[model samples]
Target: MNPFVDIILRSCTVYFFMVLALRVFGKRELSQLNSADIVLILLISNSVQNAMVGSNTSLEGGILAALALFVINYLFKRWINQSKTVKDWVLSKPQVLIHNGNVEFKTLAKLGITSEELDEAIREHGVESHKNVKLAMFEIDGNISIISGDNNLKQTHHKRKIHKTLNEL
Candidate 1:
């Protein structure tokens, strides 16, 4: 085998194994990541290094592995976009943790989120209390979205006040 071709083949094999491992492990939201998740990601790179370079430790091997990874990621993105079911399977739907100012304890528990964690999330959003919130969603991407009950009322009042001021002017 030509030296360059051998490098390419090895790189491709490493890329394939990495992608397969990632798919099998499933998706995890950034905010939802624990210590174990971080360790697994770190280990993946270390484990694949030998397979990618092997006895052919060269700059070209590293470049080829990076290129193969990019190509695989691009194809995966396109596949997810082309099918809604695939998208759902790859990226889960957002879970509603709070609705009508009531905490969905069951949902939160299922997500492995504790009450303290929920409170911290809400506090990070600058919300004083759950009652002040209309809807609080835990997005699939692991971010919290808090929709305040007062926001609608404030908007309505602001519009009315603007109209009154315009009339007076």
Candidate 2:
């Protein structure tokens, strides 16, 4: 195989593999990055560099691999946008955490969210308590969104800095 073609194929393979890994691992990871997350990401990038470029360490080889990644990513995004099935499979749907001042304990447990975290999110949104929240949702992007049941109907979003992995919880 031509060196350039080989690089492209390798890059494409790495791209798909990374995507699959992220999807399988957890989409919540995309929303926030802690120290461990950042370190792991850096290490993964370093580890995959050789796999994508192979023996060709030339500037051209590196550029070609990056180009292939960009093209593949663009095409994948377009496909995801066009196909509902693919979109549903690749993306997470928003989860309702609270409704009508009622906390969804099952949802919190499933998502590995603790009551303290929920309370913090609620307080950040300026709601006195969960009972004052009309609706709370764990959005697809991993942020907690709150809507207050007050007459003013305040709404707010809180970006979580830490997330407990499902295995840990």
Candidate 3:
């Protein structure tokens, strides 16, 4: 087997494994990164580096591995866009956390989100309380989306604020 081809295969395998692990373990923790999450990311990257490069310590090997990972990710995205079934299997549906000022406790619990987190997201959007929130959705990308309004007033107040610059939710 060619060294570059081996690097490409190894990188692709690692990428798929990481994606599957995150998909199965729940993506909630990824929304809000704490100290532990950062540490976990650092450690995982360091550990996976060896698995991707194997015995090839050359700069070319490292570049090939990285390029392979990028290409695999690009292809995966394209596949998801082209296939509805693939998209559905690879991604979860957006969850409705609050509707008509009513918090869906079951959905929140299922998503491993606390009432406090929901409330915080609402407040971040400038909603005074749950009653002010017309709709609150936990998006598939892992961000809380809140739309505030008063039915009596016949108004809509939808606001979104990014907690951090994230590559993905």
Highest TM-score model number: 2
The parts of candidate 3 lying over 4 Å away from their true place are 28-31, 151-169
Residues 1-169 of candidate 1 have per-residue lDDT tens digits of 7766666677777766765666676656554555667798789778877776677677877777677667767877898899998886667788888898899999988767667666766666667788777787877666667777665333110000112343365
Model 3 misses residue 129 by how many Å? Answer: 1.8
lDDT tens readout by residue for model 3, 103-157: 8999988977777667767766767899878788887767787777744443332
- Clashes by residue pair, model 3: none
Q: Note the residue pairs that clash in candidate 1.
A: none
Model 3: lowest-lDDT 10 consecutive positions: 154-163
What's the TM for model 2?
0.90
Every model's TM-score: 0.73, 0.90, 0.83
Can you write out model 2's per-residue Cα lDDT over 18-46, one digit (the tens) per residue?
A: 99998898665555676778898999999
Model 3 has an lDDT value of 0.80
Q: Write down the TM-score for model 3.
A: 0.83
